[model samples]
Target: MVREKNPNVLSVHSIIHRQALTAKTLPTKLTTQVFNLLAYLLDICYSLNLLNLNLQDGGSNTIYHRDAITTYTYKFQLWNRKIIACNYSCFPKLFGMLEEALIKQTDTTNKISNQLQHLTDEIKRYFPSLCYNDSYRLAMDPFTLTQMFYRKHCKTIAVIKTKYRSKFNIASGLRSALSSTQPRIENLCKNVQAHPSH
Candidate 1:
């Protein structure tokens, strides 16, 4: 209805919410393995919770939101690679569970790796902005530009400082520039009597 009233208004869905929903589609078999996959789910849920907090705290800064998303996407890729290589360090709970239960890492590693890949794929599919470098470059340019601007004006600032320092009576110049009272030229002239020889 809001959009109907104002056609130019844009609507957006929460990216974290979308990710949480996508995570719900994990296979029943995958969920059933390794003590109902509690350890795995707990790790994923904890990460997501942290991500949600980051996104929530980002407030109205789209740059911060983009950064958070980009960081999370990179982490997903890293986790996928680590899982494929049989390294479960990133998911400490899952690693501990496997070690304690004498479970072969091969059994669940493939499933988890596949799910991570799927999640990464889904994120790319949904957030195409992450694929473009131009947006990030533009977002980052302001700080760079500000530094460049200050560097370019440094000589001018130095010249101004030197000119100000060379002045003999800076306070008088400032008083002339800032004073509000007008000079009483006529009164001063009237007070001066004509010269006796004139």
Candidate 2:
């Protein structure tokens, strides 16, 4: 297999402009660690819909309840902070944290079951051959049985029907009528009265 490397590719700019001019005093490792934590936390929240969860449950948006965002958001911050303080040690720690969050989210009673029975059946059928991570892959597929159950509502929607009306062919119907064979005179029952001359 050939790997394509662009000749015009330039130097890596990951650390280029995000840091300040005082960066010589900045802890470069800490900055990278914080960035990693932010990335990971964003990934987990995205995949699990944490924002939606917080808004729906965790009490009405009172001052205390609204701060639940801070609580949940802090978990990600904690994950990042730990890594930074340890100087980029303990990725397993981060994975464990996200995994626990995922597990907890699954335990929440937010699932609509009747909508997902078909998906559950499919999963059961595939259980014999499935491997470890395949369950997550199958469960999260947009087209899977489970996803059909959950729907987002919208106020005004336009649906376009893509099929066009067929143009009628008046000439073909007339041609078929014109080409039909007439019954032979002798074979026509009405005309078959023994020809008196015959």
Most accurate candidate by lDDT: 1
Off by over 4 Å in 2: 1-43, 46-48, 86-198
User: Once model 2 is optimally superposed onto the true structure by TM-score, how far is the C-alpha of residue 185 displaced, in angstroms?
Assistant: 99
The TM-score that candidate 2 achieves is: 0.21
Q: Kindly list the per-residue Cα lDDT of model 1 for residues 28-90, writing each as its tens digit.
A: 456547452578889988998998888888354777777788888899999999988878889
List runs of model 1 lying over 4 Å from the truth. Answer: 1-32, 58-60, 131-135, 143-198
Whole-model lDDT, model 2: 0.42
- Which stretch of 10 consecutive residues in model 2 shows the poorest summed lDDT? 153-162
Can you give the TM-score per candidate against the true fold? 0.52, 0.21
Question: Against the unseen true structure, what C-alpha lDDT does each candidate score?
Answer: 0.76, 0.42
Residue range 1-198, candidate 2, lDDT tens digits: 122466665665566554644576768555544544554445554634855666677456443343444444445455445533432222444455445444222211112122123333543464433323544445446375344332321111111111112434434433433445664655667755555774
